[model samples]
Target: MATSSFSSFILIFSLLSFCAIAIPEPRPASWSSKTFGPDGPWNAVEVVIGGVGQNRTAVFPGHAWHSWFTSTDYCFLTSSDHCNDAGGYPLRNSGSSRVSMEFLQPAQEWMAGVRVAGEDGFMYLDDMDLLFKGDNTDYITKTSLAIISDQMLALPNGTQYPALLGCLSLGSPEANQTFVEVPGPNLNGTMIPWPLAKRGATPSSSFGLHIGSGITVARMQGSLFWGGYDRNRVVGDVLALDGGFYEPILLKNIAITVVKGASPFAFPSTSKPGLLAQGNSSLSSSAGLPIVIDPCSPYLSLPRSTCDAIASHLPVTYCPNLGLYIWDMTSPKTTQILTSASALSFTLPGGTNTQTLTIHVPFRHLNLTLSKPLALAPTQYFPCYTSSGTRASVLGRAFLQDAFLSANWESSRVWLAQAPGPNIQPGSNPVGILPGDTAIQSGGNDWATSWDGFWTPLSEKQANGTEGIPAPAPVGAGNKEGEGLSAGAKAGISIGVAFFAAGLIGLGILLWRRGWIGPSTSGFARQESEIALEGRHSVEMETAMPNSSRGGGWGPVEVAGTSVRDPIPLGEVDGTSSSSSKKGLATSGRHVRSLHALA
Candidate 1:
């Protein structure tokens, strides 16, 4: 019994241990760390928690914690208090006064936990490099590696920082760029303690501390992600295909013009609102397109401030339908000015309006190869008319300046070589054909016109009887219909087959009766025929004579073919002889009647 009890206890303990190991407790919020360069007053600093701990409360120094863009991926950091305690580190040091650091003037500061890498330190530029030692090094490494392991942030540019070491490239956050120091000094001319500042013990709206002496603060600048994108980069984001035959490249700003003709119900301008007065059109770039704005437009789903910022050009947007579209040439900024000069009526729900805009922008960057050199000395953007009455626009010098175009007529292959320009059709060489060539049309329509006739279509086969020749099908004819003979022909053939079958049956019956065929051919007719003939004969003989006309009453006639002969009077046969001549005459008449009946 004791052994059993001991076994039960052991089993329970093992089960509990297994459960604990399998389901781990929630991780601490402060498990990750952040690092800065040896230089003081660095530009733009953010403590990114690139892990499962994003939603967990973050305790930071001298600032309240607030959430920014919250999703499964990430949450922005803001200053706010009265939030739940993060599992990692609780803000510490409840005190009235705190340390501070001056960005503009780094010297003459008094506070606790003061550690300076250099006398006058400040981080400049978008990229930075630093080294950490002991505990600081470990913390930096932990944070950097943690964020990178999330696989959310990409380092395309070849730059290295204290904790993070990697290259950042195009389309990266670093490419966006930013400049602003996250952590600043407090009121006291000294550095603020991490725990105290995080806990709101010595909280200040800005990066300041409660101190008797004043300190010069720094104003750093940097981009979010990295360096902010330029106009060219912004435009490239649009018209980008993930997997396409043509590769897109950066297109520099080109000159352009906007046509003007005012009417009601115009596009984009009437729908969009801007700072301009009523009836005034203002076109600006939003996203990658040009947007026209009218005054007093209704607020969209976006925030009012955001909309205002966009209208004022504080932020750029490309909404083509909103009267903002990119053109071949012309700066987006210039287009706005042009609208004002033209006095174009821009209002909500404007009338039908037409505008002609010319821009020298690169339509697209293509990756192409040419099999043969193309001659573009005289013709440019010329039309390649096909015999099918379709036209293909060829790439002119305007599209492919200093670009090579190659074509192989035999292989029907064409390619744009070297600096991989845009794909455009080549002009038809009307003069290239030999003079008086039969392939050329009489109306000087070029060889292409005669290559395949347009109005006059050629048949699939010639009017000659040839087995291999292709033939055109009748209208509405399908594969099944084509496979079989005509319906009428089939019906006639079926009827002929039925008649032939009937004739065969009749011949078989005739042969069977003559013993030319088997017994079963007559179908049991021989016995029936014999029986019928005998029955007919017996019926005729019975009805012919009556029983009264017996034994030589009148007269007996002999059978012509048989040997048996007899002659008897009719009166004897009837068994009644008359008395005298008169009686005998009457009897003779009776006998004649009797004989007639028997016959």
Candidate 2:
């Protein structure tokens, strides 16, 4: 009985070990990782713009030309699509529309109609993600807002109106080769792509924004993600945006404080709220102002009164020539302020457990320049401006440098978190945002165990089925067979193939060293030359011929008997008298006929 019991224990131990080896480990669901820019954080993928079969252009992060404010109170593409002929006429004549006409009928069908509203011109539903690579891998087909080109129009008195283009036509006659058209079925104005629409009864679709250093600094890069965010990129706890305004994201009870004295003041000061309430009525009297976050603007534009309060404490002077206040970095008084001024922090409303959201901007980040073309020269400046008659304060790219913003349009909520600086490396693994009301960590065990003691490889559908979400179509796959393996499995197979290729290269080198392969041809061939007749008249060709004079040494030589003109040089001849030499040659009938026969 003791021997039988010991044998049963051994059998059970052996089975457990086999199960551990055969079962694949469960991993969190995630979208494929993409890189960030021409220069950006480590391990982050770089972003490029343009369409498939078109010239792809790298999107330079922190590039002033490409930045813009998030749309508020309007779907720019929708407005452009329904625009009248006055708005649509310009696109038909513009360079982008003419090229779209040239594409095959199938490609032309996908072209979103064009809109040209005076100076505000745009094309709708046209731009696409550069990484799509001819496949609808991200389910990003028939979406809006791909290429935006905003042109500034000068108005009366110096006021400028920005003409925003939802879809920019790359219509330059020279650059026609670079336009890439989106591939798929035609989408009507009302139809929304599955990816952009609300997902699984959720009120909002999730997206993450990581804005890197502005153009003032080098190696700047930014990241934008749809459906989820990189937790590793954020430093502090995620905070909720204020609950008013259906269009723009807003923050409440905002308070700003400058560090005083020798030691730097601790940020998010606990006593300042009460102190400001007692001392400064201008700041304390009102609730937080409606604000819009714009990545395109370099400076922070605040209410004129608020700017007056902040400027009173800092060492700043107004420049009449530039029509703006400049921070004199060279002044001794400014130097003293810089030493004590550690940072400026903005406090916002955070829901419940997380009481408040604060983003701290360092003094060094405030130092910037009025870049060329925007200014006459590169001028030292601070990133603060005053605005009058504005509905909301603008928190431009300057503020975003220190913050990570994520927006969930389907849920109608925005997440604000303090960002890791520009140099941090990205995490190897990233998780996708699950549907609303679904537990983030559940369903993995059930899917892993569904094989029921039979170890079958998990397909993408099976994994997504366990999570109660539909799997996106595999990129570039031609049929269902192509979808059998997951992206991770394909990546592993690719690595194996690379190793095999390296081994073959080593074998070729060994064979070459042992003289098993013969030498290759130099690619040149030899040809024989025939000798010229002794009595043949030789003509000297002029190295440089005059434009007006035709009868040079290299000019046509007329044979006496034949109408054909031979261009052979008989002797040294000048451009001036080649005609006389030709006449003499024509008189020698026998010699000319002999030359003609040889010609």
Candidate 3:
């Protein structure tokens, strides 16, 4: 009897120990960030669309575009050949392999009008994947990766163009990006960071983006930190501002500082010239032209007078056809301001509650290279374009190159600081953020003292002693996950589990013989309701289309993505920190919100 009892004890102990060691507990907020995209500028990711077998397709926009722009890859999901020709976009064999939004459902019928880079398309709820290419691809699925489809025949001239690239819009309220689909896809566009926050994968839904300076000099290197910020990127005093969820970001005024060679820039102005005021340059932060800092804006769309004012001071001339300031190589001042330390600064005067932040952009950094399609050849042009048709005076991708933006989404607080060059620190200085009102952790290398104020350019090694071609993404690259246990370890665990199971059976037999165990019956019943979310929330009404279905807006907009009434799930995104656990994202049943009553 003692021997049998001892054997039973050993089995139970071993099984319990295995369970304790193998099962991971809930992890502390974990953050995983990686660099993405192809050589040249832009951030690229694998967008897999279509779920119905042959119709399912994957498109990597980085490889499709023959030209270079700011950070991002873009493509239209419309099934028309005209869309391919419209934007100088490469032909995709009559939209055969295009990501045709296989996840969309017509029965639920949720659609919204979407306009991008002058091209108009209807946005739809999609069950697709947004994979961030890294050492392992990190992804959020059953989410809206923005599958916009358009019929060229519906355009004013049937000649509209697609945007050069698309953006992973990280800011905004969760309801703005998409709504739940019946048997609904899991997450939405705005909710990308939310799952990380909810799963304890990140501290909060707050993320920071530093789109490094000088496309050629930046080497397409940047950081998108979730639940944290790269402290090495911040310089001097942090300009903290409130209100990221609704009101457009307003600045006191723009301050331009230039060298002797530049004319208009040499004299700092409190306000823009007369004609520029037509576009809202004269408006104050209280109202007027709100400054929208978006990574999607490929260039600096300043007011016309602002663009002309700056152009008058440089060796660049505006090309109306392309809407770009072509650099004049023959100009005597070209060598001066282009090479000299001239800076344009954006000032946001500190209110009693907000601290002032002045971000300086180097004049040299404004000079970007243009390739075929957008340009005839390798031409140098100023990225500042006239904000003729935009909703506001916009600081596009160009501005982000010098600004480090961090938003505490839970509290709706935003802070912008000067972004330091790559070598300002030895390593990618990522610091975890505490949830809510508490901001990001401080950096490992404090660069407040060493900050050069964009006066002198940062140092860089000339690749191959000349401007080298940007690196291409590795083959089979769009995968995401932590370095998990190897196959051998997994096999071992399986075998061990089986052995444990056999031992339990033997223990049961022994206990039964000793009358220490008895067979009992118990039943568990679980029922889950698949919830569908449907509705529409619009911010700005589209001109002439008072009834236009809208999905997103630069300002505060809530877009209800039609979702599956049945439960949809967001699979777990593995946390990278040691404190994290194996708990993946919650299943569809846990997060079903009934949004069927929206107008």
Candidate 4:
């Protein structure tokens, strides 16, 4: 009946499947964002291991040398669709100096994006814990043996587990082992193409067979389960199985305070915040470990060109001129700027609580919001005194615990929304301007002055006339000289006396030639009379010359071409000729003399 019920539930679940798959939210840490925050899906999350003044020894789960909070061993695990098998391994702390980790089964695993700093000044990831939710409580072993890949183990059926992927060996005092052979149509499951099985196999061991093309295999450990409560109980807090609702759990307190000889808004103390205790600087918590802020990280939202300019003026590790202001959570309207040393310390009204240390970091330019809070880790000492790397800013846990903040990218304005704890006193709008924005604001006037008088779009103008391109002049307009010349322009004009005399002479010539009046009555009367007398003399000469000419034209005549008549008199020629000439001589033949001589 139990098997039938389980089958029915599986069928129902398959039928109710939706085409769209829901994506999981990012883990609580801000560092996870490097891969999966607002960015998207990620392959891994890394973390640093090392608590406040505590460390691990054996590098295994139960055999650990130190664990201040819990007595029993707690092994960290990782899982997804990818891994050697499905098993996980234990994470070790730094104080013990053990550097290697081991896994039990062919389980899927992931790295925690945690960073740990050594006394020598090196920073790196330590270990990660797996996220799982399930209950498998029936366990009978106190030893809780985990088989490593290098170890040799024999199975009940002539097979060895560590041959390919290792197995975790657990001893159960009870006779009934939780081994359920899921028998059904194995149409879609993980398939392995291993050529040979291991040497020993056991009936009590769990084995899974795979059958599909895309299916894969992984290993997982048993989760503690709860049944009937007994006086002699071996169970403990099941963080993975608890589903009850509770009040908000205090993670860490954040504050913004002023510090002398350090960046404004100093971080929490080095010894606090049970994770990543490298030194007192700026840091945050994500994936259960401290994530120190590297202000120089390229992932910061500052523009590339501006960042380059700033890097040239200041060292990559430190910038003394930089400042910040933040508002605490308690006083929403009160903002405090960490401008000087005296304003650094924060004292809450009810006394500050260290647990509520996480603060939300808002990035105005990236359009990103970080829910994870920043923390301050211990300072690391390097071999040389040249510590040139980036140090975390004052926006660490201690400062975040006491402030609220808002920033505007367009205006380059940042506002501290409120004060948090009682120690964080209230103030007016204690906000900051980003360095690049400040530089632009200060240099705007100079830039505008340089670009003035040049043609540009009309939209660029400042309310106070401090920035932007100036307005253009009207079309068809020139400078001062052009305006004055335009006022006197006219269609007609006259000049002085000499010019007037020339004009009158031209008028008289035009009237005479155009026949406006007779020449006799025109100007210069005596000249007109002489011209008429000359015309009469020419007419009389023409008439008298025609009368003098006789009927026959004077010329030399000859018979049979002996001689041509004398040249004809020009006076008897056609009237088109200007004048007629008198007859001078005539000849009868070539040998004949003139007519007068012949007579």
Model 4 steric clash total: 91
- Displacement of the residue 559 alpha carbon in candidate 3, Å: 1.9
For residues 18-122, what per-residue lDDT tens digits would candidate 4 score against the true structure? Answer: 111121111111011112211111111122233223322211110100110111122112121222222223333334422221111111110001111111101
Flag the better candidate by lDDT, 1 or 3.
3
Q: TM-score of the candidate numbered 2?
A: 0.47
186 Cα displacement, candidate 1 (Å): 35
Query: Candidate 4: which stretches are off by over 4 Å?
Result: 1-57, 60-111, 114-599
If scored against the real structure, what TM-score would every candidate get? 0.14, 0.47, 0.58, 0.15
Local distance difference test scores for all models: 0.18, 0.34, 0.43, 0.18
Looking at model 3, which ten-residue stretch has the lowest summed lDDT? 62-71
Which ten-residue region of model 1 has the weakest summed lDDT? 209-218
Candidate 3 lDDT over 1-599, as tens digits, reads 99989876777865575455443221211221322221114433333332222121222121000111111113433332222221221223213323222122110011112223222222333333334332112343333443233321111222343333334445443422433434434433424455555544556667666666435433324556666776766777776666552233555546455432223233344223332233343342232234556554456666566677667666688777656688887754564445444566676544454556767676556777665334445687887765224234456556776778777666767777776543353435556566565444334433322223323321122111222223322221111223335789889989987877776676667667889776666542312122223332233423112222111113323332222222233221111111232121111111111111100
Q: Which candidate would rank higher by TM-score, 2 or 3?
A: 3
Q: Return the TM-score for candidate 4, rounded to 2 decimals.
A: 0.15
| Model 1 vs. true fold: TM | 0.14
1 against 2, candidate with superior lDDT: 2
Give candidate 3's error at residue 125 in angstroms. Answer: 5.1
| Model 1 ranges off by over 4 Å | 2-6, 22-26, 30-599
